[model samples]
Target chain A: MSQQETVLFDAQGPKARRRTMIGTVIGALFLLALAVVVVLRLAGQNQFSMELWGPLLNPGNENFELVWGVIGEGIVNTIKAALVAMTLSVVIGTLIAVARLSLGRYARIPLIGFVEVFRGLPVVVLVYLSVRALPDVGIDLRGWPGGQVFWGLIIGLTAYNMVIFAEVVRAGVASLPRGQREAALATGLTNGQAMRLILLPQAFRVMLPAIISQLVVVLKDTSLVVFVANFDELLSQGESIIRNLGNPIQTFTVIALLYIAINYTLGRLAQWVQARQARGSTAKATGGDDLVPVRDGA
Target chain B: MSPVIENLDLYVDGFLTSLSIIVVAMIGSLLLGTLIAAFRVSPVPPLRAFGTFWVSTFRNTPLSVVLFFCAFGLPELGINRTFYFFGVLGLILYTSAFVCEAIRSGINSVSAGQAEAARSIGLNFSQSLRFVVLPQALRTVVPPLGSVIIAMFKNSAVVGAFGVGGDLWSTGQTLTSARGYETLPIFIGVAIGFLLITLPAGAVLQVIERKVAIAR
Candidate 1:
């Protein structure tokens, strides 16, 4: 805003400065008053009492470690699902992208259909389908070491995100000059070999920031697994702790903060990389900015 | 087939709920988002900070969490409301951030000369923005705005899942989990329910994009 001042309003004179000063104070007071009202309301409900908050966060509380231990397990399960899904989505999405690009028209058409359908639906529906529908087909995930919920979550996340990543990869490749593909083909390389040796590497570099940021979306989407057949991810664990300790507000606040902390860090990492890549091409060319809506479940 | 037919009324009711959700939240977010975008670009430092804080907090938090907070946290503060009200509020709060960023970036993309020319012509900031810059910026904004709104449409699914009961995902889940209906057919119905909302929306947005596209 400092640098872009010319667009909105010019520098303020003394009277105008006084007006803005009063505006700022009023704004601050308004926000502060809202906070006070919330605090007062919570206080009336005895929400600030130590008994409500102790078991989960207070170190001296005997149940603190026990509660956190369960949450720690939930964190592990969430990370495990996120990591496995992220790895699979990236690898399979790249292969599918290459295949979609290099394949004949007949093959590409259905691939487009598959991508479109999976991309369009909410991921929880897919997760629910894998959990329930697959079992009827004798593809039971129960015997898997991670349990049905974990596998269900992974499969759904992978299906939705792989298509998104495929488009991202394709967009990256398309952003390059046409000569890169032609030059590789001119050197007597097969199409697959040319894409493998030439195009994909450059595309990945150009797509690094978007790919990293998509991981944040992947991590956030893991929250959807909270309802996937009692998976005990971060959210459900928060629910259980609340049931035991009788504090829905504090427990969910901690859980929300945990998600924000991890996601905010990853979001920052993507921005740092984007900043480094700022000079190369516009972020639009990547088509996978942090704001891109390929995110599953929210 | 039997299960879907049996629950046909529930499907209609739930989907209708979702449709209303899209309409209500779309308008809510757009109006709120425009205000925040204006706040972000304004010369006031406090307003800019407030805008930044709001965007970062919502954008970083997961939608499920936001909805969860609404479902649970608001009640704790004695802010009682219907599940439907809370769900819509959460959607508007979470989505307005994305809309703000899209508009802000659109505002930024408008060439500096336009604002300068507006000022020279004696139009003030809001006047220039309303008359000249925003109209141009909105043209560039439509495509991304479309994506954001579609994303919001899809996210209404979370509203149903998070205890705001009357939407397609929950309707399907109740049929399958409680009533012991067939999962495959119910899931298919739910997917179609979502597609019924999203596909037409996507087509409409594409049409709007073509109509409003600027050469620059």
Candidate 2:
């Protein structure tokens, strides 16, 4: 209950110590009361009833197979959408970044406009526009099984994320020491060749953590397909489950947990990669005299 | 283009709706986020744990799912409310987590020496943080905080599709699907509505980023 006193306070006197103890008890009690009220509220609504939660959480329940199979399909569809979106965004984004990095000023201007427009608009608008609007302009974006729904979701994700990815990779390349580019160019390589061989490979590696974190965003965004195109991803599937089971809270809670489970793992991987990079960039310990080469002795 | 021009009044109504959602959610999230951020940094252990729980839960969960609960699940709990109320609630609940993180990082960015100096002058921890550290931290936080708010502006579009109608997404959807209007121009008009808000906000943030950027 007391502050850390973190180089920002003197040693506590007796009165201060007593006050800390009192505050601790009061804080604990307050939280307990809040928890109790929440539980009581849920219970009052029959939210604690086993019929609502058992099929989702308990494998022994008779409907367990039915409920989970539906959710499993949702999970598969969600992964399919997010995976396609991520791959397309990275590949197209890298290409756009390369084009901008190598092209003339006039050529880059239109590409800049493309990035700005896509980045500025909302993804739902993008999906809706791609499906409903673009057919008039000779673009029928229907190839998948669910056609407009799936493609709308993917195209929207790609349009939004590819621009962001382009920016990320460009930033990654810009972060490289100028000497790396100068060194590549001084060796007589063409600008395109230099970018492909020297700059992009390194930029992808340097930006791996940022890219993974972005994938988490993509994964979460897949659920938006429910609202935009009704693609039967995790969210829409959850809605159907709610319709049948009459347990909106419990069903959606399970769906949310599934999302958090996957995205949290990806989020951790991003942190791990970032930490590894931080460690890699720091100077390592030098070897002792005996371990050093005689010619370049310590 | 003509369709967009013909439906200018509908566009304006949608634009106003979007603006109100943004304004309400923006203020609601900032207030809630600040309180949660305080909980996070406070010395009380339970409060800190509660704060951490709020941040991680919302951070990992999809906004759609949160809105699902607000829109559908809340009725199960008998907390009936208007869709706009629930939509704004979902936005605040989700966005405040990001806001809290931004604030915590801002607090961390305040150099420790400032607090130490404040204490050396006979101030307590609370006084030092409020008077000496927070002002500096708030300045450093403006840019990232701006980005979070921009992201929220983008996310509120999701609300309209979730039955919070009369906003731009619904406006665009209704014109194309029900009215059989040309999809390209009507949706483009809707896009312009959003761009009108976010693009200028981005420029203003850039200006603020320059104005308050500290050397240290």
Docking class of 1: medium
Deviation from truth (RMSD, Å), model 1: 2.5
Name the regions of candidate 1 deviating beyond 4 angstroms. Answer: A279-297, B121-123
Kindly list the interface RMSD, in angstroms, of each predicted candidate in the order they appear: 2.2, 9.8
For every model shown, the clashing-pair count is 0, 0
Instruction: State the lDDT of candidate 2 residue by residue for A1-298, as single tens digits.
Output: 2233353345667887787678778888999998898788889988989999998988999988998998999999988999999999999999888888878989899999888778778877787776565668887767657677788788878988898888877877776777778999999988878888998887777778777777878888888777655677888888888898888888988998899899889878877876676677642121111111110000
- Model 1 lDDT tens row, A1-298: 7655666667789988999888888888887898899999989989888888888668999998999999999888788888999999999999889989989989799998888777778777777677668888778888989888788888888987898889888888887778888999999999889899998988887788788778888887888766566887888788889888878888888888888888888878887876777665564454335333333225
Lowest summed lDDT across 10 adjacent residues in model 1 chain B is found at B38-47
Stretches of candidate 2 above 4 Å error? A1-20, A104-107, A144-146, A283-298, B121-127
**Model 2 misses residue B120 by how many Å?**
3.6
